[model samples]
Target: MDAEQAHGPGGPRWWRGRGTPWRSTLLLTVFVFVGSAFAARMQQGERAELDLFARVLLLVACALLLWRRRYPVAVVFGTAVAVALYLGAGYPYGPVFLTVAVACFSAVVAGHRRAAWTALGLLCAVHLLVAYWLYRWLPPSGDAPASLGQELVVAGWVVAIVALAELARSRREQWARERAERAQAARRRADEERLRIARELHDVLAHSLSVINVQAGVGLALLDADPEQARTALTTIKSASKEALGEVRQVLDSLRTPGDAPRTPAPGLDRLPELVEQAARAGLTVEVAGEPPRLSPGTDLAAFRIVQEALTNVVRHSGSRHARVRIDEERGTLRLRIDDDGPATGADAGGGGNGLAGMRERAAALGGTIEAGPRADGGFRVLAVLPVKATAEGGEDQ
Candidate 1:
């Protein structure tokens, strides 16, 4: 949807406003000017002539009120002063009184509570003083009614108008607050989607690249040593490359069309042994000690990535010829613990740079946690715990 046509109160019409307060004030000023001018022309001919100066001053004050919303205190004071000066003239009550109401509202809308109160006090004082004077000595020439009750009723109506305007302003503020909250929620969802995309790409690239790298290395070694073994390794490399390409195409197609066919699900605990076998092929004696749990796809994916990274760490850092991995699921958490004996030589090796970091991030995203460090048993250990359902800890039942 267009920005102005977003989901909001007032059918999005409220969003179609000028960019700045100055423009809004200009529009209002032009409107007030035109309205006041029309009202003045309709006055009785003699009255219009006598109060020409009063009409001009009142129109100028009304037009000036465009800026009242921006600088409420200043405009209210200026307009109030002008109205007080013109009240004694033979001017009609409409325009002068309109200016007072606008001043009070503008002050309130500008968020100046103290100034609005001051403006209200000034408005009441000037109106009361003029009303008293008019009552004590009737201006027979003016068009005002003789009834005191009618005067009070008119004053009450003005007060009600100000209250209504304040109510509208508060409602508009509330709508703005709600709109901001919705925008924040949308941003959060977009962030999550981006993270998921990154996870898929990492898994697809890492596993596929590992297989390709191994096969390519084997092929290079057997280029003359054994053409038969070299051809087989080349075949594995071709198959791995083809699968990676297909997965990449599917990911790209899904992005272009949201309703594209779904791809195969990501592997989890069910393929833990297969993962271990793959590690074994790399000359690492990987021992799987416990039955991995059947978990939700998210938790399962986290576990798979955790084990993959842990074994990769063993192959990369631990000079150990053998590595042991154990997975235990209890109390709604699937935990994987992996340890490896030190490598043969004392040569220092760097640990998981992006691999371990990615594992920790995956665990965290699934409402899980991980720990990795050298163990006291002459080996290194990596541990990860993933929550199956909700992240909250379960009941401490005996």
Candidate 2:
């Protein structure tokens, strides 16, 4: 069988192919010989010898178990019939019935529920018929005839064997279901990790490339008229490139070995001044207000990214050169707002692109909300509110 089928629910183990049949056959042979000898010794008046015909029947029944895994129902019925015939011919009760019971158990464990139950019913019915024959035809001297208690004891044994088989089947199925669920959970975790990495790369590269593009244009414009201005622009380009490379390497290192300490602490709201300075070099003036509040690592990183992306948008899309940033925390909510006095420029003015989506995902993941749009007063605005602590239901802390 293929690997998938072999490892699937109720699937046989690999070694079962080479081991189970021979082991079962050997066990049945030992049971048949030892039990028959024990039964003969248990005889009261005269110990009856196992005739050649009865011995042959017992051997046949034991040999039939070699095919039990392949033909469980057939083996059960064949062995039961052989044992019944041997008993009818006045042969002692031995382990011939054991082969039948083992076959029935194997059938159930192999996922043959209907066949196994049918074999069990047929075996019980044959046993009842044999009991009646022995009670009517065979006279008892001093001992009592076959009683209902004896029949019940035999039926109880059959029921116990079937119950054990059913228990094993249920346990196997439960384990299979659990294994499948664990596999699915692992796949889901892998997919989520891939999406997280993709979003990180998009955010880092997009912001860095936008800054580099602006600096290169500035350098090219001033290369002949003002060499010093061009040199300053080249310096900004170099700085942006170095920052991008460091952040990219950090991301790659995280992917290589998760849980390792980062080479540098992640930037948070404390780094807003650096972001504003970078924007100033790109010819945009930024005004700031309110102090950064204490935040969870995730919320802090998300707040930084939101402000970074908003400033990058101001530089790349807004015509106005001045922007305002506001940070406020009150009653367990940390609020951030960035606005620029520039006319709306297409969808970029109203939140479009992976940057905005990434911002939204981050805020929402922390039980927070973000809103971006063109303000009625002729400027673009982005606002976000994050909870101090995330709730179990992923809602804002109350």
Candidate 3:
């Protein structure tokens, strides 16, 4: 993973080897070599007597730009100071100062607003002073602009170039702001997704484990007292185990991103019968009514989970000996209804009913709906209805 991208979103899938030390070193070497070449090509026909000190300073400042992102303010100020001394040497300058201007712009874009302004101030001040001093020393040589008006034109040209560079700086800062906002939005979405997944895990695992725990205790107690009853207990354990595994698989599926590999097919609408069977094995008189058809993969999975969670709740919470699972497909939708004649008293009051909220959340995610409350008919009922497809599949019609 690239060090520059390791801390970024989705965990480094976009780190395409772009942040290596070798690449940075190579780029800096190229910049310094180009600055030296431009320095050597000064003056027309006459061998420009290059000041050794100025040439070395220009090379150092040009090479220093590689660290601009890491130390923008230092590089900007350092380059400005070096360029001043180079200009004061009274020799024709080169393209090295352009590199400093570029670095200043990057600093501005990196959220260092105050530092960027400070560097900009020092840059304009130092360059203006250098121009004035250079003009005084040799206002106009034979090859220089012939008139005061022409000299003023050359001065204007320099100012125009600086203005263009500052414009570039502003653009970089704008781009940086946009990138920051995008990152913040991504982080917020990730946090929300994590919370949702956590809620699902809590609901499914807590409810399933509570039923299994109670059934296991019953099996152990009857093991010595009645062999036939113990056999029934073992059967209940097997059914509960299957139901728990299925719910767990669904939660894992929900946590995965699209195109990722957790492609284990979830038990959908067809699995409602299996859930009712598990309740039967747990010694509850289980009954099923109506019929819900083949739904889309998402709807099917959510519907199955709702029934399974409801059955688990009945096995754990319903004090009565009977529970009914009612399912029906109507008007392009499927509704799952689970009710138990369980008295909300004693152990049943604070019973293992953690999966109810999770089931509701699952239904909501599918663009469906769920409602779980005490039925007016004196039983606990959970009703969930889901569309064949999500609202996101076909957004609101304008």
Candidate 4:
């Protein structure tokens, strides 16, 4: 398993790296002393009492548990073998089996299923053999052999330990999977936020820069011929620049504090008149046909951007001074059309520049469609049809 999956969230670095913690060492020390003392005490008033060798073996089995996480299978096998040897040597039963049982549990929790089962089988077989040895060698009384009850109890205890370990392992794996999924979701949200910011920045800067470029050129050309006209052009540039700066700052502020109320509402269909007046100042005479209908916020913003981009293209690329805009709702669709009397050129054509692509993206996002091309009568035209409500094929209403 990978480190992230093995350790899960909030796991310590030492545990994640498969290194033993100081607590394990402390536990090993405590178990060693306790098990050795227990084995020595079980030999009270017995002719075959535990000797120094039996105590040392029990201590060694307990100490082996400190490395269980790093070498689960080996530790389990080694501890089991030590316990078997101590028992075979006729040592009295003691807490040494406690260390072996813990080793079995660690093996399963560490994902060593085969080793755990093998250790369990070995332990059961050793218990049966020890029971038979006690029956044959120890003096038996009228009471049914006590070894039988002890063996049954130890078997049940081993099964319970294995079951609990498996349960814990399953829960840890599930928690890891959930953590990974949440991390992926957070990344997706961050990417979507970045895309939204890019679209807003492009729309604001592209339209404002195009207008300033046109007005600056006009002012330069009329500088000597008509000084008054040149001053008027300069004044228009200043006004447009200031307005663009304020809008740009507002957009940035919205991003900086998304939870705060916006400084100004987003521009929508209601702001078309101001957009038309600005285009007129840029020397384009735009004629309007139909009144805009009430629209949802998303649809309103998309409609306004489509109109602004279309008019900006007309002023920059279409050499015509006159343009027509028509807005009408028919059959649950809002149809927007803009036509100019300028010849279509390669630089202003749709599908080849950011402006038209941005407009198309806006339209498509709103479950709408856009078409822009040269008209048969020697000018350019852009037509867009947006749904009043989101379409089934377009996902949500926004």
Instruction: Please give, for residues 226-272, the per-residue lDDT of candidate 3 as tens digits.
Output: 88887877776677677678767876786667777665665666766
Residue pairs with colliding backbones in model 4 are none
Candidate 4 — which residues are off by over 4 angstroms? 1-14, 17-19, 24-50, 69-77, 83-155, 330-333, 348-352, 364-398
List all candidate RMSDs to the true structure: 7.1, 4.6, 6.9, 5.0
Report the lDDT tens digits of candidate 1 across residue range 1-398.
32213423212234324223556556655665566556556765423333467657766676666666445668778877777666545444454566667666655554554565676677667666665665334332544432578467767866775786578557766777788899998898778667766766766666666666666788999999999989988877787678778766655554665665657666677877777666665557888888866676667767877787777666555678688889788887787898888743442233325777788778777677889888786778888887876343221111
10 residues in a row with least lDDT, candidate 3: 8-17
Structural similarity to truth (TM-score) of each candidate: 0.71, 0.83, 0.65, 0.76
lDDT of 3: 0.63
Candidate 3 has what TM-score?
Answer: 0.65
| Candidate 2 lDDT score at position 150 | 64
Clashing pairs in 1: 319-343, 320-342, 320-343
lDDT of 2 by residue, 316-360 (tens): 788888999999998989999999998755424233477888888
Q: Local error of candidate 2 at 362, Å? A: 1.6
Using lDDT as the measure, which candidate wins?
2
- State the displacement of the C-alpha of residue 166, model 2, in Å, after optimal TM-score superposition: 2.1
Write one digit per residue (lDDT tens) for candidate 4, span 1-398.
64324553323233347666558656765866676567567655432466688768877787788888777778889998988877666666666777777787777666676777798789778767756645455422222244557777787878787788778767766775787799998897787667656777777766777777778888999999999999988998898888889878877776675589888898888988888888887888999999998877777877888888888888778778899999999988999999998875445322236878878887887789999998989998999999887655443544
- Could you give me the TM-score of model 4 versus the true structure? 0.76
lDDT of each: 0.65, 0.76, 0.63, 0.75
TM-score head-to-head 1 vs 4, winner: 4
Estimate the lDDT of model 4: 0.75
